[model samples]
Target: MTIEHAVPADQAADLVRQLYRAFLARDPGDGEVAVHIANMQHDGAMAAVSDIIYSQEALSVRAHAEPARPSLPEGMLAISRADIAEVVAYALEAARHDAPSAYEVELRVDDVGRGTPLAVVLRDALQPPQLPQESVEDDASINRTIEIMYRMALGRMPGPADLENWRGAAGNGGRLSNVVFGIGESAEAKLIRGAFDVVPGIKVQLAFEIVLGRGAAAAEVDHFRRMVDKQGSDISPLVWQLFADEARRRLLPPQHANDPHLAYIFGSRGAVTLADWRTGKKAVAKTAIKHDVLGFESVVRLRPAEDCVVSILTSLYRGGAFIRSFLENMTSQTIFRTHCELIIIDANSPENERAVIEEFCRDFPNIVYKRMDARVGIYEAWNIAAEMAKGRYLTNANVDDIRRNDSFEIQAALLDTLDFVDVAYQDVLYCFEPRLPFEEIAKRDFRSDLPVVSRYNLMEFNSPHNAPMWRAALHRDVGPFNQSLQSAADFEFWLRCRAAGKIFYKVNEAHAAYFVNPDGMSTRPDTRGAVEAYAVSRELYRKIVSPMLVISDEEFLARVDEIDAAPLREGRRYDIVQSALLALGTRREGVVA
Candidate 1:
């Protein structure tokens, strides 16, 4: 038993290409082929081929080879058991006798032999005596059949390009069966068929599972069935409607008046104290302040106190032109120059950029510049700036983003009127291009509708980060932003505020323009940030929310897992929080029995 020698180096490329096509159902790219060929020369042909076959891409293709199908048979007329039983009985009677009454047909199908073709039997029993057959090979008949096949397989009519492609494929001596089979085997066809194959009952159950993480109640199932019957054979729309309704229902804050959890968490009725361990005392701690913070200078000062402070964190040397724009926006603010103080926290910017900051500070009396000895991350810079703030209220200002002229005034006014509102946030207008005129960009408003902030809503969704103003006391009460978190520092702080029983008020007007930079930290996909945000949310849930609800630690953690598994967008960390809150509410009725 001698092992075969490895294939020659030149032929290994061809073998690699062949394996790629065999396993992945596509030709290998030039680069892929070259890499694999090199591997084959170093290892062996068999080893190279095995590696390609077991690769993630190849395994994904293989997994999709046999797409999932509905358990129900394709082209079945009746879905309900009674209807199916009647059709079966009629088919059996037709197979047994040449001419049978409807009553006899219903009675005889149960007695038919096991191996008979029910389709043929049903066709004979259902149809009248056959007339002279028309030629279905004609253009009109073929076109009509093609359209029907497209609908049955894809759940919709084919597009012009797809229709033409199919027509060309079938034009070369094609039969109707060949066209139908080709369409039926497609991935789109399989998915559509599978979706429709699910009975109305199962669809209702799936809707409940997807939205609320539970099975539908008997009443809910009955209601969905009624909806399905009204909509006829197309139950897909009904399923979507059910899912939407359930999502809205779950998102609506539970009747908080009687919710013991809300009372415990928010201390709405003074049911819990700030010193209680259950009221997030364990989770709230001051982030360790870095003593390495060396360079500190107030380049400008104003004697008459300001009501608000605009904290801007920037690495002026790295931020480039955006830093200038940030300074211009701060100076141009309608009320900020008079009513607010601008604090620029520079993380040891270059000498040239430091000169630029000094020039701005020299020109503006209200603008103050502070440089750190060492470069601290954004979260730390935020914390340091907050500590240096002199105003009664503080709001974060971004280098590349713009705030409306009256943003500070409006938020300050709102806070003044509402003493209970610890923080005030406004809607933001998102602009893709930073160069765009603020007036033109301000037309688009991204409103934060979570008006009343609670642990439940705050955990579920995050309000706009740079668009909010908080009372200085709230910051003092909540401590500083968690320096440990890289991306979700703002979110963690917001959670802390909510945990500390601080109420957030929503100012309906668009007060800021959030510029969307492809390279920006928040917009780009950060796996670590997402994972960290998730962990933060879970800990918040355990320390703040779980204590309020009648849920065990094990059950609460399990609910967090289910929420984490949901198909949530990575950037929308609040959605994950909301989902966890929804899950906790759903399980509050009973444990996972």
Candidate 2:
């Protein structure tokens, strides 16, 4: 037999210390180093090192120091030191008495002296581990145990009053396990675990409603529920899966085949040709009345003596019920009523809708009503109304939307408080119904970074157009809303104002609610609107942005082409309209001006 020489004591001690630092993230103490050195000499170096690595202290430290191997679930609870020690103690006991053949017997230090083996210590400790024959249970002892368990599980101690109530409840023979389980399954526990109370079925329904803009079928809900269950009650991954599936469905050509609006816009069968657009544009242009030629006499009906004159402009169309609700919300303005005036420019609505506007004008004191001869677009009506506005600030109100009673008051105060702010806007909530029981579809908060409205960032994302109460002078300086652009006139106007070094401020609260009408002109897919917005963006880039930047016309055109090449959605076609604007703003450092 060949004999192998044992490692030197000093070398073994150094190796033990190195192992502690490597595995436990700390150097071993002098006593621990000495103990390992002795073990290394007696049990062989390899065996001693392996034992130290596998020891309870070393394993616990290693488990926390390194990322979990069989990766834990997203919200899994962390294993505590007490839990590790308990498990180690139980395993040692089981190996010594119950299953020595299954688990290897390694003697562990039970005390600081290292005199008693772990197995002997456990045997002595558990000698009389049985319920008392006298049945003399102390309520104080049970309460203390309950409090300790709560602290361990929930990471908080129960209030003194709450602890008394818990102790009273525990009088009915509730075990320690019962208390643990109850607290673990609480709503508070669920919050700590990062688990939502939403059911899998509701999640599937909401996913479809939000993403696909429709409700989920019974079969689809059932399929998603099964997926949620298979993934161990986690619905986020399944929600993402549904989003991918919906994206694929949206990409399919057949989905747009039946919808003539999308087909025409995308140049499919039954497409709206370039000649068709030109014919429509010419027909609208023939009856196009300029703001100056509107023939409405410039008259100031009721000029209030307030310092800040707020002109609330509303262009009424066919929506009678919405117009009434909007007027009611407007007239109910309490604080800023003395400082505000209502201007209604009727765009040839039906007799019934016109009746609603006339009734509102008669009821309200400072309201100015103007009836147009022909039905010009909303932007044209806005321009016509703005020309007649006698206020320092001007805000356009949608007839179908609802505003908070204090919205105008709040916005007016914000504008007065801030210096060099040309426009003030606030967050808005979107709801399906007009009443108190309306289902909120979305809430848009535009207060991420207030006051500092970067033109470059604004080019990327259009600020909430209807939310702002802009200074009337800005409209005069930048010119009225572009009459040629249909849907994106507001977008073009904002870019023009931004080009002239104007700033917009945000009010951090939702002071308005936008009613989402399914059949509304803005909601429905309008290819004409999309194309007009693109054209208007290009026009603004040439007239306003190009002159302000150092880039060549060819470079500017290339940037615009890149933005247009991006994927276009029906409602969000002008999403990338800001790319050219951003490019111009970036190169403005080398501007010729």
Candidate 3:
């Protein structure tokens, strides 16, 4: 390889040893260099250089060595080792920069061995500070230009001996650009540039170099250039279309024609309010569940059908972190793939969640994605998704929540077996760490704190837990969730259902895990907002359900102490309508208790 032959073997060995010591802060193990040298002969010297500088040992040492450093610079990718390694590997393999010198590699040790983002380092490597343009006939002027280039490129002034060596080259009629090019292409510079995450423009540039085997002509396709710019980091779709053997027209899988359950699939992106969404207005983006690709190794079997038993409504806002968990959890359901429909409404998240959603939408045929032009409340988004639901049953899906793989099967079977039950809620396991995969979480110690929804328990707290599956017919009878309240909207809706004489069945199993993150709305340190919302919802509940009770609101309120002292029962049912009214007093401004 060019890198292996760039310098004499003895000089290259010194550079590699310096790399191991500086990057990993340790001496190489016995025979490690020999192994890397073998790899160098097979792949290239840079590959061996990369193997040492970006190895797991290097990353771990750097991370622990500087725990007190300021957190990663804002706007950079989270310092995931895998992500960094992948991007750096690709850049190292594809970039055509000159091989670096041993001295330059030693000089860059601090920058490369710290928490500095690889992107920043790579950007610097690709575009180093320019050398000063000056007449090179005189020794004094050449010395000035060489010293400046050394300082800017290597972050230090040139030593006396180095100055003499560079000056001799300059005295021999070497151009300033040529004199400084070595410092810019030094080992340090190449290593830094290799770790940078490739931008869209660079991706296009790399594709030209690797696939087309030539630099892109200015007259090249403008559409592809625009596509790269728009796609940002993920250029695979564009790459496949532009360079792969596959036909460009078939780049995306075929979408369903006139899908009855979806509002829009093939249309321009735009915004719609919750009301507009309910009215069948065009969504900013959408994809049908039945027309997309199937997920590999999914436990759920494919059951292709036009109809489904349950429609899962997921309202996403700032949920980019939970997308992977959400998809994995949803697709792991024991029911056949087509037995349920997943409806996701994106609330104009600032994060580019739509890209991930679109990519997965192509894999999971049950995912029906819709994006709102603007942010909306969770309830508002749920209502919008509910409007487009085409199943017999409906459930709101929290993107960050976890459930057993058979949780859906259990709940759906409950509803199917008990035709009288309009709503089915199961015990929920509340835990600090709910981000673990469902299988792992299922093995955890489960605390079944949620009880059968007695009108009493629902009054005291949210008994249905967020994972309840309810009949879609309830929405037709009782209407969509209340948009007025934020925290207590679900509670208010459940009370409204109870007042409308809808029966709720509680499954005794704790298959659903409710994440109790401190930052969560209900779990935050200051719960005044939730308290006030609860008060308002209780007042609304009193107004809706008080007339349906035989006892007055005050009489029902009098039994608060009695109910608090009652013995806890796992299977006990509390059905008295008087229990629906909150014992806590309501205020004009809404009370905390």
Candidate 4:
């Protein structure tokens, strides 16, 4: 077999990312198909499998293009049929070297059955191969099994083995936070958790909730796509209608059906006023525990100063309908009742929007509108709001969102802990303004799989649910949102919490309404340049990268992946993460020190 060493380990690691991304971005040929390599050569290092998928994503990513590896970019997939086996060996070499590396391997039948390649194998023979990640959340599926302990109390449940096939279908969330409802065959009651929390695919949660069984998953998807095509509307609406129709069909038939054992899966997507589940009703039994929201757990009030919120309100270039609803909902939350404040940065908004806000101020006296004439972005606007807040905590509200009545109550319960979270929020419903509903996104639990930008614990801060209520003091120690950073000032402030050694918690309740982009819904991390000042971030990075010198090659690869994600584009989770890892690896300054 010919040995090739054209690419360095780091670049090879990138290739691995692209490959893996391709796998995820597209549908597998069949569930049975596994992209096997010379696992025997690597001494059973199946870890290369992950590298292949990740590299595929990088190669497939393009400018202004839908992400997915449809056709390989130059050299990205130009693997010769012959080098396949060698690529597998290189994977082993990289693994043995304790670095993140990969190869475009092609294994011949004879090589797979025969002797091991020498020299390279002998050199690193003593080294132990790195294993797959063993994060705290690994036992998600098992943990979920425990959540339904009552079922087990009634019967003998084996373990993760019982859901092996299911475990394979939904990856991360299914594996960790895995829930097995006793619906139909294994029906459980009205226990709904955010399905999105379990998987990363835009629609994986849909797949997990809709059970035609894995075998029928593909057919069902095709059928839904066809319905959308016939409806002559965009995918997002089609997705919503499909869910609504399904909700009506399965969970709520026009007339009730015999589904006492039916496992109900709803979301925190739309606002859910949970209350007692009864028929005119008497109390239920201890055999089953019940939960429903009669009111909201959190309230998101747009407390922009007259200078800020007003400016945004009056900017009124195109989305006027959005503005009207925003104002209407402002005074409606059940918690605020009589009074609520509005903070605006004076010079921040367009003149006309400011005019409208001033008009609203007159209409409602409790509508306290404070303004800073100086031009500032979101962070400062929020600081202004916080300074003017009469309420104990501040929710730097999104301009487009409105809160349901009980919103504040649930969040208050969760945030009252000794360690207050930087912010707290639940998945909101994706609907137009006014009567918008919180959809399935609500029931999701983000404590696990928390993204890097939102993961904070002293020395670093993460932006939690966007519309969370924050203690005004956090702004004091965390400091005002840095004007240096434009869009990311709030995010950077969160990073500061980590610097100060603090952590954010989740309420597992959806409190507010957020308008999702019509095209699709997803968030982007801020690029270093987008921040008004990269100097501080860079300083943080520098301190981070230095001590990281001692980290192993594999860790270095992971760190690099995080840094490359530095672009503040949509899906920039990768960059922020790499930067953080670099910081962690290098922080010879142990106190964030």
lDDT scores for all predictions? 0.55, 0.54, 0.57, 0.39
Better of 3 and 4 by lDDT: 3
Q: What ranges in model 3 sit over 4 Å off?
A: 1-306, 526-529, 541-593
Report the lDDT tens digits of candidate 4 across residue range 1-593: 11122334433443443333344444333221333233212412123443343343433443223434223232332222223333344334333333221111212212333443322322232235457786544446444544343232223344565555445534544433233333212332222222222212213224323421111122233223322222121123334433444454456444533232221122212221112112212342323313345434524333323221111111122233454556666655544433235444444444445556566677766555555555555555556556666655566555456566566545544455434465554544333223343332232211122233332121232335356565667767767767655455555565566556555665554456554433211222222432233344433322222223323233444666555432322222345456666665666467666
TM-score of each: 0.43, 0.41, 0.41, 0.40
lDDT of 1 by residue, 1-593 (tens): 00112445555555555445445667778898888767755643433554675578866765576311112111222112222233343233333323243223323333233333334344444444467664446656656556766764566787777777777666777766688688767888777656556445555555555544543433345334433432223444444444544554457674332321121212122332223323342454534322111113422222344354444333232566576677777777756667777777777765445666677887787777777787777788777777877777778777777876666666666666577878887656556556555665544322233435555656545763656888888766778888887778888888777667778877656667776655566655432455567556544543344321222223434555764443432212346557666766677656655
lDDT per residue as tens, model 3, 1-593:
12222334544454445456555556666588667756665544544666775577766765576311111121233322322333343233223233343223323333454666444544443343478777536777767666756654555688889889987776676766677787667786566445535544445545554553433322232223433443333354344434532232246564433222221111122222224323432332343212111235433333334778889988888787888778878888877385888999988988878888778778777789998988788889889988998888898778778877777777777777677999988766544454676544444334455556654345545667569999999988989887766666787788788768788887766777766555555545543444555354434443332221322223433453354422321111233322322322223226543
Relative to the true structure, candidate 3 has a C-alpha RMSD (angstroms) of 26.1
After aligning candidate 4 to the native by TM-score, how far in Å is the CA of 38 from where it should be? Answer: 13
Residue 261's lDDT within candidate 2 is 24
Each candidate structure's count of clashing pairs: 3, 1, 4, 107
Across 316-412, the per-residue lDDT of candidate 2 in tens digits comes to: 7776767767777788875445888888888888756767767876776688888888887888888988988887788988877777666776666
- Please give the TM-score that candidate 1 achieves against the real structure: 0.43
User: For residue 65, what is the lDDT in candidate 1?
Assistant: 66
Highest lDDT among the candidates is held by which one?
Answer: 3
